[model samples]
Target: MGTLFRRKSRMVVVDFLPLPPVESKRLNKAISETGFCSRREADRFIEAGQVRVNGAVAGLGVKVTPDDKIEVNGEMISKEVPKIYLAFHKPVGITCTTDTSKKDNIIDYINFPERIFPIGRLDKPSEGLIFMTNDGDIVNKILRAGNNHEKEYIVNVNRKITQAFIRQMSNGVPILDTVTKKCRVERINDFTFRIILTQGLNRQIRRMCKHLGYEVTRLKRMRIMNISLGKLKPGQYRHFSPKELQEINQLLANSIKTEEASEN
Candidate 1:
């Protein structure tokens, strides 16, 4: 027993090197990861002193360690991985809302196992590719009007499109108390045109066409950002490939990095 004790003491000798302290992450991220709200909204909560970590009021810029207890509005947040991202080609006549009050909302058409909300929006009368995700972080990155994510559309009008109308659209049109941003427009057929817009105003295409005295019969968005609706029929959806997800994440990362660098 004496020998064994001696051996254990010898093995337990402390090292001279100091151990690294555990780093703390921002409280906003912890709340946002729970899928409750976006990081921006989380910051608002933090500023309002509505969040508590380890029985202390969580202030803005306060860091949270792994073992720390977190509570929001007196409710404990479950640390679970966020839900998956998805994209769907919304069919015409389907509203982009989750409210059941709307009889023809997109939520009724989706058969996914998880609750996913549309990232942005496509008008009920317009059919095209729409991204749906539980990740609120990516929504601002993708939908910021200043981000200039190009949206390509094929629009069918009732009458033949004139060169003057194309020029006006490509230059800029007045709508929503603001001048529409410059866009790319090309004639596809006698009454069809393909237009690519970098700005998304509410019912922009319809309002623009209305200003030109032309009624849009159909408007289909073929692309958003770098994701194309290719071969994905209307009213159908598929999981984003690994490569596609990587590309989108990279785009968002770059945008955030750029913004941070500019601020610094």
Candidate 2:
């Protein structure tokens, strides 16, 4: 009997000896990764006392283990929630913002049953393929400058295409205080050309055209890495196939994955 009690006492002591620093995640990122909301929005909700870690209210930047019970507005968040990845054909005049306060926000426009955000912006005036996903973890890996993911676009300028223009655009053009990366530019015909870029800057193509005295009459993204726009029409969205997702995972295998620490 004494031996069993001593063993029980030792077990209790061991349990209290501070758990091997549980592999934890910040409350907001975990929430966002579960298709609940964006991390920024999660932060806002946490500050407003709508989020809880374990049974207690959560504070900003609180670290939580996977086993911790988390809730928002009295509803428990499910870690097993399905992840959604989509190819959305953004039409001109629709915004890529996640902000619900704006009428043009993509989230509101799509009205997906669950919350989601566009992976990156497709400026309101520009149209074409853009990715939207409920998984916040992959957003940075795909968008970060270091990854070098390719995005192809077909562009139409106001003036006729010139060989000099092709050469300048392909080699590099100074924009946004830095020279644009050398990208593949192929002349499709006069006034239209195709460009595949590994880097994205604010209104990059438009700015590149303006630098050379050209006005962009039309600009539409055709592809993003392994995914293509295909025949998806304006304001339409389709889920990624398992094979496509598999290939995408393979493509990003060497690219960076956003871990919990850096995300906070």
Candidate 3:
């Protein structure tokens, strides 16, 4: 037989009996891991006394185990909920923001039943495939520019493309006070081209074009990593097939989730 006694900040086991390991984690992380909300939001809920664990109000820094009963706003939260992953074809003029008050925000436009946010954003003037997911961890994994995940785009410019332009773009163009990384740029026609980038500099494509004295008349993302836009029309979305999700997980297996790690 074994008994537990409180000794300062530690629990003492009498009789030196062995006990099964109780995997534990911070309460906020537990909630986030369940895909219910973000860790920040979980902290807010705890501070506001809206979160309870085992029928007692939870506090910040609380540690919880898988067996803990967690609740929020008088509703019990399951320890595990099916994760949602989506590929959305964003439309031009739609802002990729979660703020419902913002007009033309992607969240409101999609009107999904559950909370999901865009992995990364496209400019309001551009349109194409973007990822949406309740899995917050995967966002940083895939978005870390240093990971060298490929994002392919089709672009149309206001003027005819030239050989020099293609060479310059492929070699690397100076943008955002830094030189853009060398990438694969193929001329599709006099006015259109295909580009694949592993960098995510702000307005990179447009700025690169402007620096070369060309204006981007149209831009559309065609693929992200191993996922493709396929036939999804603007403002439409589809869940990732099991095979796609499996492949993405494999690709991100070694990805770092920190911004600092992504900086050159």
Candidate 3 or 2, higher TM-score? 2
How accurate locally, in lDDT, is each candidate?
0.78, 0.84, 0.87
Candidate 3 colliding pairs:
none
Name the candidate, 1 or 2, with the larger TM-score value: 2
lDDT tens digits by residue: candidate 3, 36-153 = 7756567888999999999999899999998999999998878777789999999999998777799999989999998777787898999999998877677777877889999999
TM-score for each predicted model, relative to the true structure: 0.75, 0.84, 0.81
What would the TM-score be for candidate 3 when compared with the true structure?
0.81
- RMSD score of candidate 2 (Å): 5.4
Ranking by lDDT: 3, 2, 1
lDDT per residue as tens, model 1, 1-264: 122234644754444566699977777776666665556667988888889998888898888877888888887876675567776988888888766578888777885665566766888778988887766567677876677777899999998899999999899989879998899999999999999987777888888999999999999998887789998888889888889899888777745311110000
Worst 10 residues of 2 by lDDT: 255-264
Supply candidate 1's per-residue lDDT for 109: 83
TM-score leader:
2
Native RMSD of candidate 1 (Å): 6.2
Best of the two (1, 2) by lDDT: 2
lDDT score at residue 251, model 2, on the 0-100 scale: 85
